[model samples]
Target: MTGPVVRKCPLCGKPRSAEHAPFCSTRCKDRDLMRWLDDGYALPGPPALDEEEGKA
Candidate 1:
């Protein structure tokens, strides 16, 4: 029989660490956080309207 599947880190493709769960290490985890904090990731959506335009 085959063994349980091992998930890799999304950042470096390394085997995931239990402590970090999805990421392999604190560095990768922090990098992901930085991406979010820096607005490196975004979701698909309609463009936001300006305050002046919305007020009209």
Candidate 2:
């Protein structure tokens, strides 16, 4: 029989904790937050138009 599938933490590859869900601990969770706050993650999009260009 096969055992239940284990999910590893996205940050440290550690087993995920029920409390943290996707992360293994608060540290990893906080790190992921920091990455977001610091613009470490971004979505695909075209360049934004500048205010000057719109004014022209």
lDDT, candidates in the order shown: 0.97, 0.97
User: For each candidate, what TM-score against the reference?
Assistant: 0.86, 0.86
lDDT of 1 by residue, 1-56 (tens): 99999999999999999999899999999999999999999999999899989995
Span of ten consecutive residues with least summed lDDT in model 2: 47-56
